[model samples]
Target: MYLTSSRPDIVHTTCLCARYQAKPTENYLKEVKMIFCYLWGTINTGLWYTKDSGFELTGFSNAYYAGCKDTFKSTSDGAQFLGEKLVIWSSKKQDCTALSTAEA
Candidate 1:
C-alpha cells in the first residue's frame, strides 16, 4: 500500500487489492502480481530526482466520451510533473453520464 505514494499509476489497483488484504483470495493475489509485473516492465519510466535540474511544474490531462464500456462513463486522467519527475497523477470515471461526446 505504501508503494502508492511514489507510484501513483498503480494507486487505484493497489487500493482495490488492499481492501482484501486481511484475507485476500487467489484473484487478488494475481492482481497484485500483475501490478508488480507492470512496475517491472515500466521500471525505466520511474521518477528520479537529480541535482541541477530546473524545478518547473507541468501538467497534462485528457478525457474521452464514454470511454468505459462497463459503465459507459467518461474517463479522465492527469499527470503533474516537476522538472523530470512526476509528482502527481490520477485517473477516474466521471460521476455524471454524458448525453453526447461534446457534453463529456
Candidate 2:
C-alpha cells in the first residue's frame, strides 16, 4: 500500500500477490522477492511533481478479462493525473466475473 503512492507500476502485481496472503506458497514468496529485486534495481527512479505543470486533469482506465488465474475474475486498473503530474491510481480485481473483453 505504501509503495503504491509512488510506484503505480507495481500496483496490479502487488495487489494480486496480496490476495494470496492467507495461503501463501513458495511461488508467492518468489514473486515477492522479484518485487524487492525490481525495487532495488530502480531505487533512483521516483515520481516528481512540478509546480510549473498545467492544471488539467486526465484519466485512463482498462480491464483485463479473466485476469485472475485462481478465480477467473477480471482485473481493472486506472490512473489519474492533475495536469502532467500523476495524483491517483488503482489496480483491483473486479467483484464480478467478465465473460468477454468488451464486458470487462
- Give Cα-based local distance difference scores for all models: 0.80, 0.92
Q: How high a TM-score does candidate 2 get? A: 0.93
| Count of backbone collisions within predicted model 2 | 0
Q: Which candidate gets the maximum TM-score versus the true structure?
A: 2
lDDT of 1 by residue, 10-50 (tens): 97677557756898889989999999999999887766778
Question: Per-prediction TM-score, please?
Answer: 0.60, 0.93
User: How many steric overlaps are in each model, in order?
Assistant: 0, 0
The local lDDT score (0 to 100) that residue 38 gets in candidate 1 is 97
Question: Model 1: residues >4 Å from true position, as ranges?
Answer: 9-33, 40-45
